[model samples]
Target: MAVLKEKKLGAELRSVLEAAFPGQEARYFLPMSIGNAPEHADEGAALILEGRKTLTSSPLWDYLDGTIPFVGALGVLLDGAGQPRGVVETTCVEIMPFRAVTEDMVRAYGEGERTLEWWQSVIGNLYRTSAIRHGATFTEDTPLIWEWFRVVRRL
Candidate 1:
């Protein structure tokens, strides 16, 4: 038997957005959650809900060429249990090397020790491991896509 996953989130992409912003339209949206694990996902999503985390970063190499998120991009934030929790709109996007990630940005991540040192050691390791897992190489100078978003609505 096939295992079922992520049942009855009770909202589709369009419905979720519409509920949040009546008459608003988005050309596309990417369903997203914060972490690779259930605990981390819950923690990160909570931060977003609390208005603590407005910034997030991803390896530039993670996106297909020309597919990096642009300003005004819509995303649905999900909790660890795979429940849709909120909608976010990208307000800004910037590129920076991993080592150059600023203190403010890490604070906006609002997780862990919430420091640059913690990010360099902990979040950095996560990024490095992901690169390796994907058969890609990463370095301190690896570019990261830093996105600043606003919580558009809580679902």
Candidate 2:
């Protein structure tokens, strides 16, 4: 189950965090998508390591209290294989609607085309599918948490 995998990942990440930062405390160990399609986890991790992809987005409802990313929060990037590949420090976070996602955000996403049209098409389909599974509705006004981060270390 995803929960069990996440628990295992948490333990592994705790060890990595201890070895990497020694005394520092990590805010979270984010596994891109638990049970859903990985989407761009591998490419995104690679981009982060290369100092290219610095932005990411998630549905606001996904987090408790609609919490957005914090300025110095550290995250461990997990690959499709559920392996830790790198660490990133959040630099900025913005709350916006899906339709308001910018061209810059699309480019930073580092996915195919890097155009707003392309981004919309892809995200729309994804959101629609998710909404169907949850018995919800998808719309352009769907709230999203946009985060910009920088890779601090590669594992």
Candidate 3:
């Protein structure tokens, strides 16, 4: 795999630092977007910034062995256009089966219907689409990377 050795933070991230924490050193991890659609991403980012959304469920297959998110890891959340919007740090991480996700876990996201059924349906659709894109199979027992995060700074 190709790796970038030394690169500066992007313009969006720089602006966020300048606005919220000038001259303070910060290190954020992967670049991630909340949702696939621009409008959906915007809404999710808003909820996150307002402390309304605290949880995210991601497909575990997206990560290789030992590549899963860990507690205290920092990541930059980007908008649909790939512009950084906020920095979030993972406070907890769990690997669980999709069908086994609990209501509490879904409610922790703090958005939409705030119910397990709603979350299952929405996430199921998203994951299903992703599976098709990647030529993979998705099932009720699919493992998921469930992360709980807190906003560090918002742009």
Candidate 4:
């Protein structure tokens, strides 16, 4: 229950995140919250709050800390109090076949038409199911990771 305020610079956002999780590291940056506007893109970053390998025999062999690699992350900017304030997120992960399904799906997206449909229909369905039931491992509340996102250099 924190208030994630929008600032004029990436440094503001970075400072907020770094303060919240001192030891965590910001890894990647991407465009976010693009409301169908091809040119409107915002800077986004992710930090692995905590990570550990899942010791389960399911399709997800390891939990990479924070949202699963394929699943779109649930992002919330934290406030000084370490509470979620601002939020940014996508409905689903962009990558597929994930670890459970065949890795070929990863290549299919760019390979051919059949590959795309197979990835969208068959493989996507499988992954959605796996996520819903979470057949792999790890108990409830032990979410892969707590993620955050923000738009930077935006007017």
User: For residues 1-155, could you state the per-residue lDDT of candidate 3 as single tens digits?
Assistant: 00011124576665665565555444444556666567777777777888888888777556644466678766677665667788887899888878987888777777679888887787788788887987888899888788888989776
- lDDT top scorer: 1
* Tens digits of per-residue lDDT for model 4, 1-155: 01112222266555544454455434312212211121211111112111111110113332433224222332333323333334333233332223343334224222114343464455345435555664553333222222222222111
RMSD of 4: 15.3
Relative to the unseen true structure, what is the C-alpha lDDT of residue 106 in candidate 4, on a scale of 0 to 100? 28
Top-TM-score candidate index: 1
User: Who is ahead in TM-score, 1 or 2?
Assistant: 1
What is the C-alpha lDDT profile of model 1 across 19-90, one tens digit per residue? 676665643356667778777778878888899888888885566544766798777788878778888888
lDDT of each: 0.73, 0.66, 0.70, 0.30
Q: Return the lDDT, model 3, position 21.
A: 52
Give the Cα error of residue 135 in candidate 2, in Å: 2.9
State how far residue 77 of model 4 sits from its true place (Å). Answer: 5.7
Which residue segments of model 3 deviate by more than 4 Å? 1-27, 64-66
Better of 3 and 4 by TM-score: 3
Superposition error at 142 for model 4 (Å): 33
How far off is residue 105 in model 1, in Å? 1.5
Task: Quote model 3's TM-score.
Answer: 0.78
Candidate 4 is scored at a TM of: 0.23
Worst 10-residue stretch by lDDT in candidate 3? 1-10
TM-score of each: 0.85, 0.81, 0.78, 0.23
Model 2, stretches more than 4 Å misplaced? 1-9, 33-35, 38-40, 64-68
On the 0 to 100 scale, the lDDT of residue 73 in model 3 is 64
